[model samples]
Target: MSATFNFTFDDIPNLERKVAIVTGGNSGLGEVIARELARKGCKVYIASRSHSRAEAAIARIREDIGTDENLAFLELDLETMKGAVMAAKFFMKLETRLDILVANAGLGGIKSELTPEGYERNFGVKHLGHFAFVSTLLPLIQQTADGNVDSDVRIVIMSSKSYENSHPIDFDNVRTTYHSWFAFLTLREMLQRYSRSKLANLYFMRELADLVKDRKNIYVNACHPGLVYTHIFDLSTSPLPWYMQLVGQLEAKLLGINVNDGVKTALFLAADRRVVDKNIKGILMYPGPTDGFVYFSNIYIRTINKLGLDDEARKQLWRFSEAALEKA
Candidate 1:
C-alpha cells in the first residue's frame, strides 16, 4: 500500500486544541508549514535561530490566518546541541503535550567550516543537531497520548530530492575531510553531505518507526518538498552568478511552486491518518497534482534498495546517533 494522499489548505478541519512545533518555522517552507497547521486550528510553536525573524513570521501567520490562532516562537540554533536542548526544555515547561514535530530546519551548503563545538556546518546543523532536538523532546512526544488509544504523535521530517545522491554517513570522519574552498567545489561537497544527511533522516525515521511501532500512535515519515524557492538557495555554498539568480527569479515567476505548496508533503505526513501504521515506514513522498498535497512514487525505491540500507545501515545509524548524543 502506497502512502500518498491529497488535501487542500481550506479543507483541513478544526484542530482546536492540538499543538505543533515546527523547526525553521520562521521562514521559507517551514513558515508556510506552520501557517497551514495554524489554519487547521493547531497551536504552533515556531522554532528558529533568530528571535526577530520568528516574531515576524508569527505576525505573518496571524495576518494570514486572520484569527487569534495560537502561534508563537522558540529560539533554536541547530548549529549547537545546547540550543536544541534549551528549546526542548523550554517547550516541555510550556506545553504538557506535543502532537506534531516538524524537523524542518536545515542548511544547504556552506564553506567548509566547523561550528563552535567543532562539527561541520552542513551535517552539524542539518542532521545531528536536529537529532539532538528530537532526542530532547522524545518524552513529550510519547506523552502526547495517555495510553495510546486514539492519540497521535507524528513527526514529519522535511527531506529533499537530494537524498538520492548521498552515501551512508561515515562516522570515521563525521567532519568530512572532503574540503573545497572554491564555490562550486564546496557546493558539490555540500550537496553530497546534505544528501547523505537526508538519507540518514529516512533511516532514522525508519528506525524510530520500529522503535515506537508497539505504541501504535506515533507516526514518523520523511519527505522531499520538491523544488522550493526559499532560503535553502540563499544558504547554497555556490557563489551563484547573476544569471543563475535571474533564472531562478524567472522560474519562480513562471514554473516555481509556492513555498506553501512545497510544504504540502509535510502537512500530509503530519496530519493524515489513512496510512498511519508502520507499514508505510521510510517511504519518501512528493507533491501531488493539486496544491497543498502529496503522492508517493517509485522513482527512488530502487535507489534505496541499491544502497544496501536494509538492516545493517539502520542499525549503524542508530548506534552512531546514540554515540553522537552521548558525546554532546
Candidate 2:
C-alpha cells in the first residue's frame, strides 16, 4: 500500500453553499463528520432516528462552532426501505440540491436479530436501507451534477475492513435469522454476518458507480474507518469465547483510534479535492496510521475472490435490492 499525503480536519475546505446529509449523525463518527461539515460553512442535516439525540448533538455542535445556522435535523430511520425513502423525499422537498450523501449509519457487533422488516439487522440498515435512501435521492444528486459541470456530487457508503472476513453473501440468509442457531454457537457467526453487510455496502458502491459512470460530476465511494472504538461492540461481546470476551470487553471500552481520526477517511471522500482530481470512485477505502488512505492494489478488484464483489454478485445485489424496494 503506497502511503500518500496525510489528512486532518483542517484539510477539509470551505463549503459556503454546499448541502450535506450524514445518516446516524447523532453520535460517534457520524456526529463528528456532520459537525465538521457544518463548521466548514456547509448546510448540514444530521439524519437520525432519534430527534432528541439529534437535537443534543446539534446543540453540542452549535457550542463548538459558535453558530447554529448551518445545522439542522432530518428524521431518518435506516431499518426499513420505507423510512429511508420517506427521509430522502423529505430532504428533497426541503432542498433543491444535494452535494453530499453519507450513508454512514450502520449496525455493529449485533446478534442474529432481524429488522422490523424481517431482514437481518446488519444487512437491513447498513445495506438495504442505504440502498433505498440513495436510490430515492439519486435523481436529485444527478440533477445537482447536471445543473453544473463543476458540481462534485458525492455518495459515501461506509463499509469496513472487516469486509475481508465476510462469508459469501447468501441472499436467502438476509431476510431472516437463518443463522440464528449458528449465531448463538459462536462469535464468528456474528462477525461474519456483520462483515457480510459491509461487503454488501461495497457491492452497492460498486454498482452505483457503474450506474453513474458517465455522469462526470457524480462520485460514489465506500470506506472503513479502520479499528475505531464505538459503543456497538458491547452488544455482541457476550457471545464470544470467554477469553476473547475479556479482550473484547476491554477493547470495546478502550481500543481503536480516536473518533476524530476515524472520521478522516470519510471526510476525505466527502470534501477532499484529491478525490475529484484522481476520479476516486467505486472503491473501498481504508485508513492508514495517520491520514488519507493506504493505496491497495485491489482498489477496483471487485471480483468474487476474497475482498470485493464480482459483477454477477453486484448485479444480484442490485436486483434483489430493487425488488425489495418495490415490495416495500
Candidate 3:
C-alpha cells in the first residue's frame, strides 16, 4: 500500500439539509460512502437497479448510522438510457436541490455483451449511462448552485487507474463481435474494454469541467478510489479463467485496501471544505502519502494528457452520447 491518505469520514462536516445521490449505493465503495454521508446528516438517495438490494442497503445504513431520516432508494439501472432518464426524473420529484451527485456505480470484467440498446455493457453503464444522467440533471444541479452561492454543488465521477491501459475509444468498433479466442486472451480483451469505459469517465469529467467552467459554483470532478477488495468481479456468478482468478486473489490479498479506506478520496471530493474553498473542478482526486491527505496535484496528468484529455474526442463523446439517448 502507498502511504495512507489523511482524509477520513471524521473530516466530513455536518451536512444537515443537504441532499445527495449515490449511484450503485447498495454495495461496496458506494455503500460505504453513502452510509458515511448519511451519518454526517445528508439526505442520501441510494440509487440502484434492484429494489430489494437498495432497500436492504438502506436498512443496513440506517442501522449502522442510527437514522432513517435521510436514506431512501431510487431505481436506476444503467443498462439502458431510459433507466438513466427515469432515475433523474425520480430524483427531481422528491427533492428541489441536488447538492452532490456521485456517479459511482460501475461494472468490470465480463464476457463481451451488448445491452438491448446496442452498446457494450461496460461502456454503456460506466460512461454513457452517467453521461445521460448528468446531462439530464444539469439544470437542477445548476439551479441549486445558483440558489446557494456560498457553497459548491458537486458531481463526482468515479474512475480508475486502470484507465491508463486504455487506447482511445474506437467509436466504430465499440460493440465488438464476439469470437472464439484463448481464455486468457479473452480476459485481456474484456479488461481492455473495462479500461476504455474508465477512460470515458475521465474524458467526460475533463470536458464537463470545461463546459461548465463559467458556472463557478458547480464543481465537476473525478476520482480513483484506490484498488479495494470488493465483489465488483462477481466471481461467484461470473467466474474468471482459473489462472486469472488466482492472480486476482493474490493481488487482492496483497494490495487491495478495505472498502472504508477506498472511499476517502470520493468523500474528500464530495465534502472536503478545502476542495470547495479552492474551487477545484474537473480534476481527479486520489489518496496521498499521509492518512488524512487527499491529493489533487495531478498524479495522473501524464496518462490523462495522453489518453483522456483530448478536446475533439470529448466533444465527439458528448455528441455520441446525446445521439444514443435520442435513439433510446
Candidate 4:
C-alpha cells in the first residue's frame, strides 16, 4: 500500500541472452524465480544441493516452457567453502559471464547440528556458504557488469521478515567454545537464535550494497518473500505440535501465496527498470500483498526504512561481514 513503488511487470523487457544463477532453484521461491527467468529468455542455472530435485525441476520446467537451451542445473552445497568454490569454478568454465546471482538457498534453524564442514547448520548454509559463493564468483559478476555497460549485474539475497526478531551476526561468537550449545537452549532461545541468523541475512545484503556502490552496472540487494508455503517447516525439530502444523496448513490454504508469487518481488527488483536507478543501488525490498488484477506491489518504503538500514549501521555491518568472509 506504499505509494513509493508501483506493482507492474510490464517494465521488464525481454532478457534473451542474459545468464543467471539461482541457488535453491529446484523448489520453493527459487523454483519460481528460475522458471520466470527461463520464460523470459534468460539462460538460468538451477543450482541445487539435490540432484533428484534438480532433475525433477528441469523436467517440469521443460514441460511447462519447452527445453530451453537456456536452462541447466549444477550441484552446489552451500554448507562448505569447497562446494562454493567448485561450483563457481565450474560455472566460470561453462559460461563467459554471469548477469545475475540469486543467493536463495538457505536453511531455517535446525535445533540438532552442524553441516559436514562443522559449522552451525543454519549459519553455515544460510550465510557463510553463500558468502563464499559470492566471493568466488565476484570475478564473473564483475565481468558481466563491465561487459554489459548498460545493465548492472544483479545479486539478490533471499532474506526474511523474521530478521526483526534476530540479533546481529556475532563475529566474536561465530565459532563457539561449547559443542553442546544446542542442548542448553529452551524453545524460545532456539527461536531467537534462528532470528539472529535471519538478521545476518539482512545485514549481509545491506553491507554488500554499500561495498559495491561505486562499481558501475552492479546492484546488490536483499528481500523478504513474505510468508509462502515451503518445506521449511519440515525441518523443524521434533515435529511441531499438531496444532501448529495445522495452523501452517490453514495459512497456506488461505493466506499464503504460491512460491511464484512469493518470488515476484525479487524478480521485479532483479529485472525491473523502473526501480533500477542509482538510488536503488542497494535496496532492501519487501514483496507486499497483491491487489486483485495486479500480480505484485513494492512495499519497501513503508517497511524497510523503519528497520534501521541507516548508513552507519550498514557500513559497520559491511566491514564486519567483509572481515568474516576474509577469514573464511
On TM-score, the candidate that comes out on top is 3
Comparison by TM-score, 2 against 4, better one = 2
Give per-residue CA lDDT, model 3, range 1-328, as digits (tens): 2122357678899998899999999998999989999999999989899999988898988889888788998889998888899889888888999999999999875656788788888898889888888888888998899998686888999998788788888986676634345766667777788888998999888888888899878888888887776778554433366677767756765666667777877888888776766667788766443221232222221225565767888888878888889998
Give the range where candidate 4 is weakest over 10 consecutive residues by summed lDDT. 177-186
lDDT of each residue in 96-153, candidate 2, tens digit only: 9999989999866555677888898888989999999999999999999999878899
In model 1, the clashing pairs are none
Worst lDDT 10-window in candidate 3? 292-301
Winner by TM-score between candidate 4 and candidate 1? 1
CA lDDT, candidate 3, residue 97: 95
Instruction: Let me know the TM-score candidate 1 reaches against the reference structure.
Output: 0.87
TM-score of 2: 0.90
Q: Please, what's the RMSD in Å of model 1? A: 3.6
Compute each candidate's TM-score over C-alphas: 0.87, 0.90, 0.92, 0.85
Q: Write the per-residue lDDT of candidate 1 for residues 126-210, one digit (tens) a residue.
A: 7778888988898888888654477777888876667777776776656654655554664566568778778777777777777
Candidates' lDDT values, in order?
0.73, 0.81, 0.80, 0.71
Q: How accurate is candidate 4 locally (lDDT)?
A: 0.71
- What is candidate 3's local distance difference test score? 0.80
Off by over 4 Å in 2: 1-3, 178-184, 236-246, 252-254, 289-307
Kindly report which residue pairs in candidate 2 clash with one another.
Answer: 302-309
Greater lDDT among 1 and 2 belongs to 2
Best by lDDT: 2
Task: Identify the runs in model 4 with alpha carbons over 4 angstroms from their true place.
Answer: 1-3, 8-11, 172-186, 235-243, 289-299, 302-328
